[model samples]
Target: MHLSHPTPLQNIMESKTCSRRGILLPFNSYSSHKKDAQHCIFCDTTFPLRNFKGKAVCPTCSQNILKLFLEREVR
Candidate 1:
């Protein structure tokens, strides 16, 4: 009996086609813009800002603010 391993070329091609999860898509539809990077108001972490919206806080803090608002509404 004989076993055959993939060649270096095959390995490279496979890596380019797939990620840690599954096959790579032709185009990344969810890709976000990288030009508007800014620091989060609350945590001060740098992240990409979205669209034309002016947000001082990052998404995490925004979600937290929403949660707080919902909690206050339920009370």
Candidate 2:
């Protein structure tokens, strides 16, 4: 089908990593029905939701995010 512009795959659906976003992150998406685990926002690292308070971000991603925030704060 012909179209003026096509939308990105990630922006078409809700992201599984974040709270709310019209983004479909395939790499971070899991087909399993296990509700105890989740994938990280930046990377596909599996983590427990209970420990992270429902946040799907892993330690590596968290550290990177922290570093970025600290750098921005420093600047």
Candidate 3:
């Protein structure tokens, strides 16, 4: 039997390295899961609960919650 030519995915998979997006997809998925599954990392009391663009405001405080989030997690 004859083999088919390699597809783009086959090329990526056969290579020793992953593309930038491929390398980061798991990180993005994890971030998305964390962003979706938990409350605002700032106040730690309000869940985003609705939006998937990955944004939400704390119900009790006006703050750049995403900034607070990354700061908290990096420690």
Candidate 4:
């Protein structure tokens, strides 16, 4: 069985050790338009209050906290 050679782009992608990770926001999104910012209780990042959706913590931290809680419960 003969193996096909990888494309230049595929080789470049495979050679890279690190890649972009975590949440990505658009330049012209609703989060960018918000003028008011608040600190998350968990991460303490200054994100828009609207991101919390009436909660004390931002969505990212809230999700992380939820994951940790669920993991503990499963264990």
- Candidate 2's TM-score: 0.31
Model 1 alpha-carbon drift over 4 Å, by segment? 1-37, 50-53, 66-75
Error of 3 at 53 (Å): 8.6
Least accurate stretch of 10 residues (summed lDDT) in model 4?
A: 47-56
Best to worst by TM-score, what's the order? 2, 4, 1, 3
Off by over 4 Å in 4: 1-37, 50-55, 68-75
On TM-score, the leading prediction is 2
Clashes of each: 0, 0, 0, 0
Q: Candidate 3: worst 10 consecutive residues by lDDT?
A: 18-27
| Per-residue lDDT of model 4, residues 3-42, tens digit only | 4998888888886856856887657765675575557766
- Report the C-alpha lDDT of model 2 over 1-75, residue by residue, as the tens digit: 776665676555534445864766566445565675567755677763223445677777675877756877898
Tell me the tens digit of each residue's lDDT in model 3 across 12-31.
78774754544333345556
Please give the distance, in angstroms, between residue 23's alpha carbon in candidate 1 and its true position after superposition.
27
- By summed lDDT, the worst window of 10 consecutive residues in model 2 runs over 47-56
RMSD to the true structure for each prediction, in A, is 10.6, 15.7, 13.4, 11.8
The TM-score between candidate 4 and the true structure equals: 0.29
Least lDDT summed over 10 consecutive residues: which range in candidate 1? 28-37
